[model samples]
Target: MARLAYVIKFVADMDRAVAFYSETFGFPVRMRTPFWSEVDAGETTLALHPASDANPAGSCQLGFNLDDLRAFYEKGAVTFSVPPREQHGTLLARMIDCEGAEVSLSG
Candidate 1:
């Protein structure tokens, strides 16, 4: 079977995007440049690309399997769409990413 490798999200500002993921999720920066950056998101790498006419922003919805959803919310780096709540027998929190993409944190 093929395995997942990475997910790329286009952002308007590379620095801000890098800061958001790095600080919010504590994903270490694997590589950084003005046009692109990559983070080590454990099993798969999360990449940030510069937004253009072809690659627009807010193009992906990512869900992170987290151990501490409430603690992440308390960081206040992301705009939580909803507080931690039960969904399908698991704790979940929805939020808008730095680039306005929807993301979920589940525990």
Candidate 2:
């Protein structure tokens, strides 16, 4: 079986993107620089890359398996994009990130 490691996201500002993820989820930073950064999300890593003419913003949606979706959602500095719902025997909600990307959290 293949193991999942990282999910890279292209954003407009690397600093802002890194700050957002760090603050929103409180994920520890594994590595960080001006052009690139990565967050340690337990079993997987969330990577952030600088957006350029080739890499547009809001490129894709990133999903996270969390324990308390509602609490994390409410406490975080994020705008709710999709309200919480029950599906697949879990609670899920989608929120907009600093760079307009959709991040789904499920518990």
Candidate 3:
């Protein structure tokens, strides 16, 4: 299997996006640079890279499967899920990340 690495996002405003994700989702900033910033969410990382373009939809979503989906599902908030079903011992959902990139949540 091809192990998941990092998902890169193009962001015009890094500070605001970073603050939004950190304050909203509790993801920690793992690294930052002049052109990019990386945030850690569990074992996976999300990259917010500087982009000159204004539109950011063409970006792809990256997912990391969980061993315990119930914890996430049972959370008091965050009710958004894709397809809204469980199959093959996994649940799936898509969420917007710090940089407004689509993120796949599966377990």
Q: Which lDDT values do the candidates have, in the order given? A: 0.79, 0.76, 0.63
Could you tell me how far off, in angstroms, the CA of residue 84 lies in candidate 2 after the best superposition? 41
Residue range 51-106, candidate 3, lDDT tens digits: 65443633435765656555665763453535336765667655555666566666
Which residue pairs collide in model 2, if any? none
| Per-residue accuracy of model 2 over 1-107 as CA lDDT, tens digit each | 12344576888888888889999999988889987789988887888887766558856446677666777777766798787899768787777878876676667
Instruction: Report clashes for each candidate as comma-separated counts.
Output: 0, 0, 0
Winner by lDDT between candidate 2 and candidate 1: 1
Order of candidate numbers by TM-score, starting with the best: 1, 2, 3
lDDT of 1 at 54: 55
Judge candidate 2 at residue 55 and give its lDDT. 55
Colliding pairs, model 3 = none
